[model samples]
Target: MSKIEEVKAKVEIGKTKLVPALVQEALDEGSTPAMILQAMVDSMGVVGDKFSKGEIFVPEMLIAAKAMAKGVDVLRPLLAGDSETSLGTCIIGTVAGDLHDIGKNLVAMMIESAGFTMVDLGVDVPAEKFVEAIKENERVTLVACSGLLTTTMPALKEAVQTIKAAYPDQKVIVGGAPVTPEYAAEIGADGFAPDAGSAAVKAKEIISV
Candidate 1:
């Protein structure tokens, strides 16, 4: 099989140590950086699908993401770094009073695998911090607000409202256990995702429009 296909296969199987070398080999074999990166990205889509379908779990998904990340490192220099070919920059965080990060971290990885440059602001992030991060970052195309607890749903709404007020045209996506499509729309979010895999798909869909 071709080196690019091998890279894809290894990445899908969560072969973290082998993917980097295979990616480098693919490059040496005349495969373009975009070709190799796209191969890895496609593999990530497969992994995400499995997770969404319950065929795999979080540990497996994390391992695959880590493997793809290793492969990405090999291509970064040739690709002009991670975000050069990305859909755009995505600023993500868990809204204020919410210290939960497992869900937020998963969504961040899934979105990054989908080719958006991720700027993770971490947990317990204030509503104002989301706006501040947008102002502080470059090429900010999307903002993601996450809230795991029902109590923090208000903080999630505030985050969306704060961002929309700052940049009316900016795309913002909200998600987590307590966030619903109705709530997402009610708060003026451009999109809503129910889980990490779907979050990546919705992120790409919203950002494209």
Candidate 2:
């Protein structure tokens, strides 16, 4: 198999060392950093597909994301500075009343690995804060919300409504343990993801549209 394919498979299997090793090998072989970065992104793309299909769980996805991140660090200087290469920008946070952030953090990292610039707002973020962040980062095309509890899920709706009221063209995406596409649609969110890997895919799709 090709080196890129090797990286993808290692990410799929959650091999922590394989990612950095593959990245180093690619660099030593005279591969451009952009090529390595693309391979890393494509690796997560496959991981995202598996996640959406329920072929993998959160723990596995998180590990794969971690591995991908290690590889990205090696390519950042070479690729991140290339404005022409990035897909878009994203603003992500766990909605107000939700202190749990492992899931949200993973999604944020996954989105970053997908070649999007990410501004992570951390946990327990209010709707107004999201609005303020969006106002400041005009390039942010996607607003990703995470709420692991049923009670906190309402904050996702509030954020979506608040953003839509101010910026009618903004897109809001929701995710977390308790969030579903049905609930997301009910709350007027633009999209929904069940896991971090899928969240990356969702961000890519939403931003491109």
Candidate 3:
């Protein structure tokens, strides 16, 4: 098989140790960094789908994400764009009372790869922390909130409302398992995405407006 396909397969199976070397080999074999990165991203999508289908559990999903992350580290410099023309800083975090970070970390990685500098607030973040991060950081054009549990969905709303109220023009994107496009609209979020790849797309789209 081709090096790129090998990279994808290793990532899909959560071969954290081998993915980095395979990603490097893909690059050496004339595969563009973006192509290799997309391969890994696609692998993550398959892992997510498997989870959704109950074919794999959280441990498998998490391992796959870790493998993808390792592969990304190998490609980061090549994948990154010129910082002088960056979209802007993006502050991301899991909403208060939620401890899940697999989704949030993936979104942050994707958004950063999309050319936005990211300031991650980590998990269980309070609403005020989102505001503070915006205030403290320069040119924070987007705030992406993630919540993995239905119970923490309210915190997502509160975070959006709090950020919007404080900075009326701030662009915010919300996501996680329990969040929907309709709910994002109702909660005053500027955008919503179901996964990391689309989160990057939506983040770019909203910030350009």
Top candidate (TM-score): 1
lDDT of each candidate versus the true structure: 0.92, 0.83, 0.86
Sorted on TM-score, highest at the top, how do the candidates line up?
1, 2, 3
Cα error, residue 26 of model 2, in Å, equals: 1.4
Per-residue lDDT of candidate 3, residues 1-209 (tens digit): 99999999988899999999999999999998878877876687677667656788767766777887788788878867644536789999999999999899878866765657789999999999999999999999999999999999899999999999999999999999999999999999999998776677788789873
Model number with the top lDDT: 1
Query: Per-residue lDDT tens digits of candidate 2, residues 1-209?
Result: 77766776787677887788887777887788888778778878888778778988778777887888787777777775687667767899989998998988888878887888889999999999999999888577888888998888778889888988988888889988888789999988999988777788888888773
Weakest 10 consecutive residues of candidate 3 by summed lDDT:
78-87
Model 1 clashing residue pairs (backbone)? none
Q: Give me the overall lDDT of model 3.
A: 0.86
Residue 174: error of model 1 in Å? 0.7
Query: Following a full C-alpha superposition, what root-mean-square deviation does model 3 have from the true structure?
Result: 4.3
Per-model TM against the reference: 0.97, 0.87, 0.69
Q: Please list the residue runs of candidate 2 whose C-alpha ends up more than 4 Å from where it truly belongs after superposition.
A: none
- Tens digits of per-residue lDDT for model 1, 112-190: 9988889999999998899999999889999999999999999999999988998999999999999889999999999
